[model samples]
Target: MSGPLSSLRVLDFSTLLPGPYATMLLADMGAEVLRIEAPDRVDLTKVMPPFDGTFSTAFSYLTRGKETLSLNLKEDGAADRIKELVKDYDVVVEQFRPGVMDRLGIGYETLKAINPALIYCSITGYGQTGPYRDRAGHDINYLSIAGVSSHCGRADSGPPPMGIEIADVAGGSHHAVMGILAAVIQRQQTGEGQFVDISMTDAAFALNAMSGAACLAGGIEQKPETGLLNGGSFYDYYQTRDDRWLSVGSLEPQFSARLCDTLGLSEMKGLALSQKPADQNALKEAIAGKVREKDLAEWQSIFAEQDACVEPVLTISEAAEHPQLKARGMVIEVDRGDGELQRQLGCPIRFV
Candidate 1:
């Protein structure tokens, strides 16, 4: 069967991670995504290492099921060609700085004149109208500006660089996709499309979630190793005897009891719920000491049938080989445009 977004057509003008990722999601759902890249400009992903024969694995995965067209936007007739494509395309996703698209004569207003029903989504670092709109920024910059990196890492190390581009994918790409879909729904009702301005900094600021709410409403600031979910409580990762780690999220009372009983610390289970720094630290240390007595494999076997929220911390390759992921079919093989299938992470959205 065709995917849910079979009727949608997307013109992806973004590069690197954010916009391409958004288009990748749309393409996974059967949307016709045409990625437009500059002929002279080189996308870093295209030349990134770890190539699958001729194509970069990262580039191949991101551009899966999408058509590509190379065009020099500054050259004559380029804007005309884009305008022609916009007539048929349902959505336009761009990742340019503030007025770059306007300078190229393919800005939202210019395209809206051609296609009134065009859903134009722009993903930027600081948004289109902010003072930092013209300023260049990356994932780390956005996270730092949004107060995410401030409370993320350890107290001594400040903020550690993220393994993944959280601000780029979670903030920009996700919000852009959500805005585009929401605009599509609105367009269905009103027959007029709207502009979607997705700022990574803005979205990252919103990602504070519980911490932001508390700080805004309760005047409580969350620091590293201070928040319960951050690292304050015993509900954290512990190192095993083999030096491997296991995440323990036994937050609820019943789960905590089970975890404590399993670790032979049933007497100290009450300390798990204590908010006092001393009590929390004592319990955290106790659990850490107990966990270090056994290897990860032993702990895994011990917690196999346990109800507590305990799981081993697996590497990326290990995670790909995990049984749960395999059972859920989280790994998929997509064609690399040459009939060669490369393994990639499957779409998490499940439709019956």
Candidate 2:
């Protein structure tokens, strides 16, 4: 069956991960997403390492089902052409810094004047009209500025940068998609186009909602590896006998008790390890000892017999080929040409 967004037309004017990922999601839901690229701009994915010699896997994954068009916005009539194109499009996504689009004469105001029902979304590190609106920044910088990175990493360790681009993908792309959907719904009701100013900093702050809540309550200051969710004894990763890893998320007392029982540590029954730091450390040591006795598969089998919320940590390839993942169609094979099929991560949405 076709998807709900089959009738929608999206004009993607942004490059890189965030904007591309958002449009990719729209395309997956059956939107006709036209990706506008400059002729002179080399695909960053090509410059990035780990290409499969056919196309950059990043590009192949993110740009699926989208038509590519080359256009130079700086040209005299380019903005006019874009304005003409916007009249028929349901959404226009741009990731330029604030005022860049306005300077190009194709900003939300200009386009909304041309088409009153355009869902124009502008994504940036700092939102429009902010003190840092025009300041240049990337995903890491945005996360740091938004205080999202403050709660990550080891407690005693230096405040290292997060490996993933949380600000870009989670903050920028995901939020943009959500904003676009909301705007679409609002437009349906009011028949009015609205400008969506999505700031990565704001999105990052939203992403750290739990930490923010804790901070606001004057509880733990969200110290890394010391929090309940981080690498605490009750809920963390432990290395098995074969150097494989298992993640235990038995945070609650009931589940923690069950985990202790599963490991034959009945002495831990009456201990409130979660509340006491000394007891928590002892519990950690005990769990690590038990986990070290077996390989990851053995622990997986043991956990399957109980409801300890324990799971074996799988590598990317293993995760792709996992039975549950395969059954759920979380990994899909796409024809990459020349008789080769590339394994691409599937869309998470399961449309009923």
Candidate 3:
């Protein structure tokens, strides 16, 4: 906790992924984040799997480098006490349906009345004012509304729920962080704080930059498995002989040429993203055929010297131990309240 945001203090009322992770990034960059937990209800994340004797690995891992305070905000004096404490904090992050915070007497207006320079960030599925703002949603629903789900998964199978909470992490968490930091800078210049309205749906739509650009520029809708990076051509997953998967991301022409040469599919070198679906499918199948002829280990050895973005699809443990992440210090050992050093995700942003 000794980075750029060391002097800042964040008061977080976010329970699950979005707000917690946003504050987690801030805490990693040296903000003092105080998580205010509801006394009556259990944090759902605390009950999730991969536990160490009933302690949730996910919850413990995410809550590292932060302090928690349990309080019943419904209590008579609790809101007042919170307001008093908010006077000192630089930022406040909350993830509740619209008006919930206002009803609790802890809305942005209420907080700002007490501290004018407070940066209030509200993370929600739709936002604070939209029609869907009050509606309940998770990552999937947001992705669906943002048109991101339509471009995901295979075209034949239709869109499937992404394996990870892409919307929550990418849309909510990362966007909230960006908005909060931007607000921090704005506050420094204007000597005032403002509300950061972060909608997961909006963030997901923004993440559609690649597909969105093509759709706007070409006046064409993007179907699943049609975009270059979205499994359109040879730049996709191929099954190895051992049933393991290898991701082929040779999108650049040079890399595509190298990949084609490696697999003896030299004709597909320049047609990495052919407008003709039949041609693309043929090239993909040809590459897939070559890949399936070898086991994952054999292919790994064969591509050892290659600069292509081809690699085995690894499990979480394998990814944590991968040399790329290891070299970047993305996998770290941390003490998550057990007085023992346990493994958790590390700081991705390096100051240097």
Strongest candidate by TM-score: 1
By TM-score, the better pick of 1 and 2 is 1
Please say which candidate is ahead in lDDT: 2 or 3: 3
C-alpha lDDT of all candidate models, in order: 0.93, 0.85, 0.88
lDDT by residue for model 2 over 195-224, one digit each (tens)? 898898999998878778888786757777
Please provide, for model 1 over 1-352, each residue's C-alpha lDDT reduced to its tens digit, 9 standing for 90 to 100.
1699999999999999999999999998889999998999999999999899677998998998899999999999999999999999999999988889999999999999999999999999999896898899999999999999888888888888999999999999899989999999999999999999999999999999999999999999999999999888887999999999999999999999999999999999889888899999999999999999999999999999999999999998999999999999999987777777889998887788
Cα displacement (Å) at residue 43, model 3: 0.8
Show how many residue pairs clash in every candidate, following the order shown: 0, 0, 0
State which candidate, 1 or 3, has the greater TM-score: 1
- Supply the TM-score for candidate 2: 0.94
Any idea how many clashes model 1 has? 0
* CA lDDT for candidate 2: 0.85
Model 2: residue 37 alpha-carbon error in angstroms: 0.7
Ordered from best to worst lDDT, the candidate numbers read 1, 3, 2
The candidate scoring highest on lDDT is 1
For residue 141, model 3's alpha carbon misses the true position, in angstroms, by 0.6
